[model samples]
Target: MGDYDDDTAFLGQTGPYFWTTFFLLNTVFVSTGFNGFYIVFIGASPEHRCLIPEVNLTAAWREAIIPVMSADGRQALSQCRRYKLDVIRNLSEQGLAPGRDVNLTGLEQEGCLDGWSYSKDIYQANIVTEWDLVCDDQWKVPFASSTLFVGYLLGSLISGQLSDRFGRKKIVFISLAAQCVSTIWQSFSQSWRMFCITFLFVGASQISLYISAFVLGTEMFTKTLRVVFTTLGAFLFYCIGYMMLPWIAYGIREWRTLLAVLSATTVVYIPLWWFIPESPRWLITQGRMAEAEAIVRDAARRNGVETPLVIFRRPELQTLHPGKTYTMLDVLRSKNLRCITLMCLVLWMAINVGYFGLSLNTSNLSGNPFMNCFLSAIIEVPAYVMSTWLLKKCARRTLLSTFLVIGGGVLLLIQFIPAHLEYVALALEMAGKFGFTMAFSIVYIYTAEIYPTVLRNVGMGMCSSAARIGSITAPYVIYLGTYDKVLPYILMGSLTIASSVVNFFLPETLNRDLPETLDQMQECQGLCSGPKKKKCVENGGSGHPAKQHEAKSDTA
Candidate 1:
């Protein structure tokens, strides 16, 4: 590709504008299809249902079910045993739920004798099966997350490489289409086995989605706003999902119904089939001159600027032969490239171990798990904002290391606090959340910036796969380490700190235009050979001869 001017550069920044719109839409409804909420489904108190089955608890429980509100006093609701309450209401109306506005005593299920466990407050009690609800099979639910992550690890590795070969825009749509199809299939899953299998396939597609989403965002934007736009694009994830899930969940109580609703969300993305632009960089690299020209022209048209179509015309570079495959070995040979690969993997693992692990622990923070999840995720907005601000001012090393230390310290502090101290735990967890959120945003931008242009996608692929690997193992570690409440958090804290130590060896990327070629990558490492080759500096980027001449001149 030839050099682009300010107008065309601004067009790259504009790419994020388009992504920011649809990405938020996707996050609002679609992303919810993938979650560990099954943790709550099987592992939660029996009051929560996994699917739509009205569990027969008639033989369980023998304690009196207390009513929180009573005309006389806090009276018992049943015949000296637990009684089930179902709140029926008109879908179109409010304030007419069965027990509150109508008689429920007559509608109670037969053989209603069960038990009620008193809430911590004496004012209320919750009915549970008098007999313990056996959750043996349910205990395996968390393992589903591991399986999903394995899918993610596999998909990220595949899709990241595929984008380079197949093109980023195509993969973005394919991943979305795949996720939608998977969720739609999930809505129809008849058993837990089918549910797990469908979700596993869904998991495979999601990592591909994450990879292409970032790839599209970066390829569309200019060097100046690249990190800014990409980080902000990620913020859309929590920004929309946190608010929308509770509303959607409340209405769609059945898991299958919820899955169907999210699957239908793909319809909104379908219009992108028409409006979304093919990635300009992908176009140039693939040497699709005519198609690439039209996209740049359209972007220029939208922005009221002119980009000569010739700039999009094919350039005579080392073009790929038909079916010429890019192998993993190409990624391994460059020392600079190898370091970037290592950093991407390290940063990804540390972030997932910290991000997912903290999200799991945060549920224990408050009485209402929904409120806790939302409130903590809500606080993540400021974290993303803080990340953007810091990215602008701090060196990559300084910002990443600072957040690593801070997040690690706060996570460690969670160990000393009492388990029931919910509010204090919330405060500490939020601090940890803030730090990790920044670290997460930083790593995304940092990995993209550090890799040379040719290998950026595969480099990101390795980083993303590393993250999925961490995510897969995070639950297993948490489940096993539950022997001690503090072990998991403490361990994750150490991982982030280790990431801090590793961040030092990576070069600072602030103010550096992205390295486009191998020789430019060498200059980035302080290995530029000589001064005379510097004459071609104004020529934009060139190959080894430009720099090799400088080495020859230095000998004189």
Candidate 2:
């Protein structure tokens, strides 16, 4: 592989132009985060019960007409039951006092016959309020969330190839437009089915926008800038967006209004289409050398740096063979790649399940939902910082394994806390979230480091698609908690720990020069032979022989 950086050093690696592009990409990422998690709040189930109109009784008596019943054997207000309306109506009409005059428990109870009434204390409106998706239809709410992840799965499978075939810049705008249009449609949806179907588009567009921006940033920037952009710039801004969602939901109150407001934010990105440039690498792959050079020249001019008239033609930068193309089969054909890909898929799925499960389960926590959601998002800042430092110091396999076990173990422990000690349970759940946060942050970088460049996108797409399975299943996992509070935690914890055990089999990728070909990847098998063999290769053996000629980083 040719080192394009050597020929393009004149462009200035970390310049004002780089920062400008970085921030623009970060802005798009921020919106992606907003669209991705907003469903948590928009689909929230607020305090509700069967609608009992005060047609003939005093307000206090009217409220008392609904019989108190336990759900899942846990004491709570019954959401699906009400005193037989005819019985209650007759009693009120006869001027008979309820509770005292009649045996409310002996009275025949029935589902919300007329309709269900909702409490406005927590939320003025949500999907639960608008569509009556409670009790019998309660499962629909999480399935509604699952619908978005289904879109994510589809997007993950197709977006990478689409961006590779089409330009990243083109797909981004198209996905953004699709997302905005579908979200508007969602706001206007009269039925739960319509809302769910439109959210599929929202999910697809959200992932497409995120992947396109990520690929473009990876190809356009130098090493330091790419690392910073991938970590602090894009990711940190995403956390900011995630943290903003609860506040937005708190202020908007109505689900439709919130959807409309969030949809409107997409329009803000349209102008950036004119400013963000296409990936020069992709342009070169398409044999559009002149166009690629023009972009580089413009970048140099913006940064006030001088560049040669023809930097791309240099011997070190001239191998424009369009790079090796890979498909899913290419990954499967190799024994080493197959194991690595499968392990990564399992790990990603577990991490996502734990991450989204904890995220969506916030409403069920004992505190204010907004505060819980905010804390969930806020905790990631430190997690990310810790992950960055650990990545340099710890072996990838060891760090990933340890975090998964910690996260999973904590989740399992949370299941044991008594109901009265809700705050303590909340603390343990947060601790679990913090652990999964670290694991989630490391997995992306680990996957990138594991795959060779040719198969990187396919590998990442496959793993992320697997992750969508976890996400698609996550809402249902939360639903399981209603049956038994410990079920979801047990499932998530078990999966995490099981995947952690599998982590030991995978080779540690820390500090290794990324494998560039199938042959180079074969050398990765030696990772199992122990650090002595790896150290011998790093010192100048068959492994990463190419690194000897490359400039060693001072940071490395």
RMSD (Å) per prediction: 10.6, 3.3
Candidates' C-alpha lDDT: 0.61, 0.78
- Of candidate 1, the 10-residue stretch with the lowest lDDT total is 121-130
Minimum summed lDDT over a 10-residue window in model 2 is located at: 522-531
Candidate 1, residues 51-85, lDDT tens digits: the string is 21234222212111222223123343432222343
Which candidate should be chosen as best, given TM-score against the real structure?
2
Give every collision pair in model 1. 12-221, 60-130, 60-131, 61-114, 61-115, 61-130, 61-131, 82-114
Per-candidate TM-scores read 0.75, 0.90
Residue pairs that clash (backbone atoms under 3 angstroms), model 2: 51-117
